[model samples]
Target: MPDNERRTDQRLERAILELLDRRAASATICPSDAARAAYEGDDDGWRALMEPARRAARRLAAAGEVEITQAGRPIESAEARGPIRIRRTR
Candidate 1:
């Protein structure tokens, strides 16, 4: 990966935690929130970062810093598909 791609992954990881910090303890955030926070475009360009954002969340989940949920129930990141929400681990 290029330096820029590496940087984006790092940024996405931090952004994920930072974004979660701003939400209520019981609230959750979508991966797009981190993608948009790390994105520099005004258009839908952040859409391209979708998978990267998900990967970031998965990494965070593996570290036990965050919980990946589907339909309000915690699930393994590898099994997560479709829409998902992220909340800091308690």
Candidate 2:
């Protein structure tokens, strides 16, 4: 990947982690509401924020930092849906 793309990816990862931390502290996040408030506060686009959030979630799952499961089966689709929760593995 290009240097700029790598930097953007890192930034997204960091942003996602920060958001997750905030959610953990608050116990929940209404995605639509939070995204709107963030955009109003910083002029960031919701799609920009969401793309990275999804990427970061996938990376976390691959690293075992978070587990992605759907119903009783492991998720096979990148677009799979269900409840996604984070847990500390260490």
Candidate 3:
């Protein structure tokens, strides 16, 4: 990947981490509103921002920085529904 792409991926990962941190601290998030607010942009713009974040989050979950549970998948702060809440692992 190019430098810019790497940076963008890093940014997405950071954003996802921040959202997970918020959930860890807050317990729950209103997924629909949170997603809209976090990815405030038109369809294409939102997709551009969120697709990267989603990919990054998956990687992080695999790496164990974030925990993923089937019962309650970490909420993708970019989607209104369907996300299980994600939490930071000890």
Error at 36, model 2, angstroms: 8.4
| TM of each candidate vs. truth | 0.94, 0.50, 0.56
The lDDT leader among the candidates is: 1
**How do the residues 8-28 of candidate 1 rate in per-residue lDDT, one tens digit apiece?**
999999999999889898889
Candidate 1 regions exceeding 4 Å error are none
- Candidate 3 lDDT tens digits, 1-90: 999878777766666666666654535322232344455466645555554555665677678786544355554344524454445654
Better of 1 and 3 by TM-score: 1
Model 2 ranges off by over 4 Å: 23-41, 69-90
Question: Would you give me the overall lDDT of model 2?
Answer: 0.50
Ranking by lDDT: 1, 3, 2
Judge candidate 1 at residue 48 and give its lDDT.
Answer: 93
Residue 47 lDDT in candidate 2 = 52
Positional deviation of 10 in candidate 2, in angstroms?
1.1
Poorest 10 consecutive residues by lDDT, candidate 1? 18-27
